[model samples]
Target: MAKEIPQILKGFRDYLPQEQLARKKIMQKISEVFERFGFAPMDTPALEYYELLGGKYGEEGEQLMYKFEDQGGRKVAMRYDLTVPMARFVASYPELPKPFKRYQMAPVWRADKPQKGRYREFMQCDVDIIGSDSIIADAEVIATFDAAFKSLEIGEVKVKFNDRKLVDQVLTKLNIVKKDIGNFMRTLDKLDKIGEEKVVESLVEQGFDRNILKKYSQLMEKSSKGYVNQMTQLLSGLGVEQMEFDKYLMRGLVYYTGIVFEFVLVAKPEFGSVCGGGRYDDLLEKTTGVKMPAVGGSIGLDRLFAAIQEMDVVAPQTAAEVIVFNLDENLTADYLNMTTNLRNAGIDAEVVYEPSKLDKQFKYAQAKNMQVAVIFGPDEASARKVTLKNLREKEQRTVDLANLVAEVKSMLW
Candidate 1:
């Protein structure tokens, strides 16, 4: 017979109930932050036409997307990010309110090599503001991200910002054609990953003149705003200025024209930006053929989770507040009724369903981390009373049924 199949995939693992509880708490906190900032929730289909998602993400992103022919023989792919799909959403539904602030939390698929903190399929917590290009939007996005990380109880995170126009001015001065800009920016994007020396080598390998490397290297080294202006001004020598700080940002797509930004964890520098976004002025024209400027950002939930785990900042597991101990077989129904009443009162109570000895029952309650255990013994049930046991304090009280609500309320309150 064939060997038994494993329960999980290579890059994916099953989330146990305790882990799921933690995840829900984390998500709830994030959602609250987003809502407080006036961002509402929205969702779109996970699958999109292959062509729809193709040119939005850059060369590397397109490669990682999971694409295949559907049953109807239509080429489709799981969305790789919320931004691209939102672009399509705006284009398809032109009537959407202007400057819409939306938050989307969903899973996306990618076919990529999995590592310690990287996975092929992962979730993204995205917040986007469409139909505006004001610097205020850009600044607010960064500020909101700052608040979000704090709300998550994660450590300090920095938002690295740059302009696409600067890169463009440098390339234009070098006499590179418009067609080569994509290739050039793609190479520049790897500067963080490959380092200056390797990136220069790759640029040369990509058929760029070696002499052009010196000026770029000098500019890249002097990336500070002051140095950048000096290089562009001195190098251009043109009567009119070009490649202002706002212009030379890293443009991943044609839609993004200004103010690209990313969020990085202070503790894990090499893990890459866990959340990033930028302004896109031309995405509106894709469908409506009308220019509408927009800005947005995405949180890499998977990467953030791993980094937080490494930093030992995960939420503790505590599901049940009170467990109804199971000692007498006949009193099981009584315990169930007690737990049910507790539940109706908005208390987290669970009836221990299994038959066990008295000591074992108490041990089970303790093991489950229950703070309190309600006992419905025959005597207590017959007398129309309940025994409330506070295991942590090693105390017990027999409360009359008339005061049951008040008794439980006092402890819970």
Candidate 2:
């Protein structure tokens, strides 16, 4: 029989211990920030009925979704993002507290062309407020964005903000019909990627009057300048000043009805926005025929991890702080006892399963990034002593079994 090749899908890759550990730490810190703002945690299923998600995301988003027919012959789609699933969740639970606030960190699948900092399957950390229309709610979500990045210590970032209504107003002034507004907003969204000249050229090639598009460009510039609103003021009072209005920030989601925003690491602007979200006042209504105002922000965990890696943010490679070596077959029980004691004392400890040579065990401890190693051989066991080796500092000391926990704690600190 031929052996199957060990290869991952083209747009997918695996994360080894070091990368996964760092990513986990980043997610934990972001979760902490989310909770600080009084947001509770929630999640939805990976698959939703295809109709539940259809006509929600823009045309491009719909094309990027992984949709198929299940064995039951029901059309289902892998969740493209947390927000749409969240809408479905909220509509399903109408009894949930009004102004429902939730934070979800989970993997979402997209059949997108993978590139640097972009993946087909990636984690998204989302915080949303349902049933609230106050500008303060928008400010709260933006402030959470500020606090999250600060908590990660990922250097400085600037949150660029805009409103879908602003886009509507501009297009209205340009005499663009309501039916054409979505396409126009999508075209304007390309300004950052294709500069003003190319965007105008594309619009003109699409048969939009050159003079109207020229005016549209001027209106966007004029609108962005000196833009101040209740949302900005609320954010200011909340001490979230690392943000500005970006008229071109037309979030591609068709559900957005109001404010939209995104944050980018100021030092890594080339990496693009690591987080983005906005008010989608009409999504719930569309999903369940119940109108509820909602706002949310989502951190692209993969992009965030990539940015931090590029910045060399250090994270622990292992959760284990100490490794208890199995130095003697006869002392295995003793090593197990010590490991349990360390753990019970609120220390993360691990014990090798079998006896091994001292050098080999020490190398294993170092490879696992253990800060301390406990060595209890036949001799030490006889003396009721355990040798504590500081793997990081390369120092060793012998202590009584009674002092084993205390000595290891001191070494770790």
Candidate 3:
């Protein structure tokens, strides 16, 4: 028999306990903010019929999908984003109320080359409000994202937003033909990545008139500022702050029909957008033949988590708060009982299953980052008392068994 390989595929990863716990903490903070804004929790399958998801994302986006044929010989693709699946969901269930709002935290796959923060499989935390075309919905989505970042305590972030309609207007004013609009907008989206000179060069190479390109550039600068001012005032009125109007932000997704936005770290602009989304008013109608206006955004959990770690944000090292050490095999019952009492009191406690040397147990507790270690030796067992040691502060106290829970709680906090 051949020895099996013990390696994970490239662009995929396994989260250790420490990383997983930190990820959970971030997700919890996001989920709390979503619920506070009245978005209900929901989920959709990771796989969908290929035709259902095809062409929803633009040409480049479709190329990045993890597509294949199932064993049953049916074409399928892993979902690229939650929004499109959500549109299909709304269409499938007509009885859902208008302006339906939902929050989903799930993994999506993209077959793109892996980089620092880019992964083939990553988690997206999404919140969407459907069946409403009002800018108020857009404001609420932005505001919800603001609340989430504030809660997470990530440093200052700037929300750069623009309306696709404004881009359309600019193209029309430039006499850009309708057939070239998609290519033009896509090129415009790359302005930040490639400099202005390169963008112009690319557009000119695509046969756009240099004179018209220059005109379009100048007009966009002026119009973008005007639109930014209007949006800033509107968002301020809705209690959202720090919005910058970006004329060049053409979110690469083809479905976005209006107002698109992205969140970038103020301290690390090169890290790219940590969160982004926009209005897709025609998506539901296009996919399910039902008209439903929608606007939403997604926080790339993997990227955001990486950013938080890079910023030196402190995270808890262990899930267990206290570990009850086993001093002797004979004291196993006592150790189990004490751990149970602590757990029943709403504390996360663990007991050593196999009696081990005191040094080994202490080392284990330290490795797990446990806050407190409860010593249950024969002396303490006979006295019906426990000696609690603060692993971090290196302090120890002997307490009556009756006060064990209280003593641990005081030390943990």
lDDT of each: 0.74, 0.87, 0.89
Sort the candidates on lDDT, descending order: 3, 2, 1
Error of 2 at 303 (Å): 1.3
Off by over 4 Å in 3: 1-4, 211-213, 221-227
- Tell me the TM-score of model 3: 0.96
Please give me the total number of clashing residue pairs in predicted model 3: 0
Candidate 1, residues 1-413: lDDT per residue as tens digits? 99998677778756676667777787888888888888889999999998888766767787888899999999999988787788777777778888888889998887878887788888898888888776667666656666677788777676666766556566677788998878877777777777778878988898888766677656654555764454344324422211234222374655677667777788887777788887777766763466678888888887887788788888555588788877678877777777788889888888878767778878877766677777777787789888888877888888996676568677656
User: Residue pairs in steric clash, candidate 2?
Assistant: none
RMSD (Å) per prediction: 6.4, 1.8, 1.7
Q: lDDT: which candidate is best?
A: 3
Measured by TM-score, the strongest candidate is: 3
Tens digit of per-residue lDDT, candidate 2, span 1-413: 99998999988879988789888888888899899999999989999999998878888988999999999999999999998889889888889998999999999998999888999999999999999998889989999989998998878989899988777888888788978788778888888888988988988887788776578768877775545566677888987878788877888888898889999999888788899999999898898888999999899999888887888876657879999888778776787889999999999999999876888988888888889988888888789888888888889999999999888888877
Count of steric clashes across candidates, in order: 10, 0, 0
Error of 3 at 97 (Å): 1.3
TM-score per model over all chains:
0.84, 0.95, 0.96
